[model samples]
Target: MKNLKMKAARAGKDLSQQQLADLCGVSRQTISAIEKGDYNPTVSLCIRICKVLGKSLDELFWPEE
Candidate 1:
């Protein structure tokens, strides 16, 4: 499923995909893939993304029931 929560949090922080990717030490395509559900990121990558967006892993990556 798409990680819309992460995308929203990134937008809320006023960051573009490239900015978020730089903060997380990944490429813009990686971030885009994550958002679009075309990729499943590693746990460490998820943590890095959550930290950059000021969100918890549960908040950004958990599957909603």
Candidate 2:
């Protein structure tokens, strides 16, 4: 899995992990795990993230092809 470009993009928007986590209804650790490629989030989680980031799921997560 790719390390999260999501975090980078969020940072570009000046959003902190805690802020993003709150917006996404998840923990900071969950955001950290996602950023580190340490967790494969559920589809629902992915959708939440994408929605929060104003991105589509495909823009955030690509399969390991």
Candidate 3:
């Protein structure tokens, strides 16, 4: 599934995909792919993204049931 929560959080923080990717040391396309559900990030990358977004892993990556 697409990671809309992460996208929303990024928007909430007024960050573009490029900005977030820079903060997380990744490419904009990588960030886009993650949001599009075409990429599954590594645990360390997930933590980095969560930290930059001021969110927890569960909040950003966990599926809602």
Reference-based TM-score, model 1: 0.97
Instruction: Tell me the tens digit of each residue's lDDT in model 2 across 1-38.
Output: 54557877788778999999999999999998999889
On lDDT, the leading prediction is: 3
Compare candidates 1 and 2 on lDDT and give the better one: 1
The residue-by-residue lDDT of candidate 1 on 1-65, one tens digit each, is 88899889989999999999999999999999999999999999999998888889999998998
| Model 3 C-alpha lDDT per residue in residues 1-65, reported as the tens digit of each score | 89999999999999999999999999999999999999999999999999999999999999999
- Error of model 3, residue 26, in angstroms: 0.3
**Model 2: residue 18 alpha-carbon error in angstroms:** 0.4
- Give the Cα-based TM-score of candidate 2 against the true structure: 0.87
lDDT of 2: 0.86
Q: Worst ten-residue run, lDDT, model 3?
A: 1-10
Shift of residue 62 alpha carbon in model 2, Å: 1.3
True lDDT of residue 21, candidate 3:
96
Q: Who is ahead in lDDT, 2 or 3?
A: 3
Question: Residue 33's C-alpha lDDT in candidate 3?
Answer: 99
Clashing pairs in 2: none
Candidates 1 and 3 compared by TM-score, better number: 3
The better-scoring model by TM-score among 2 and 3 is 3
- Point out where model 3 deviates above 4 Å: none
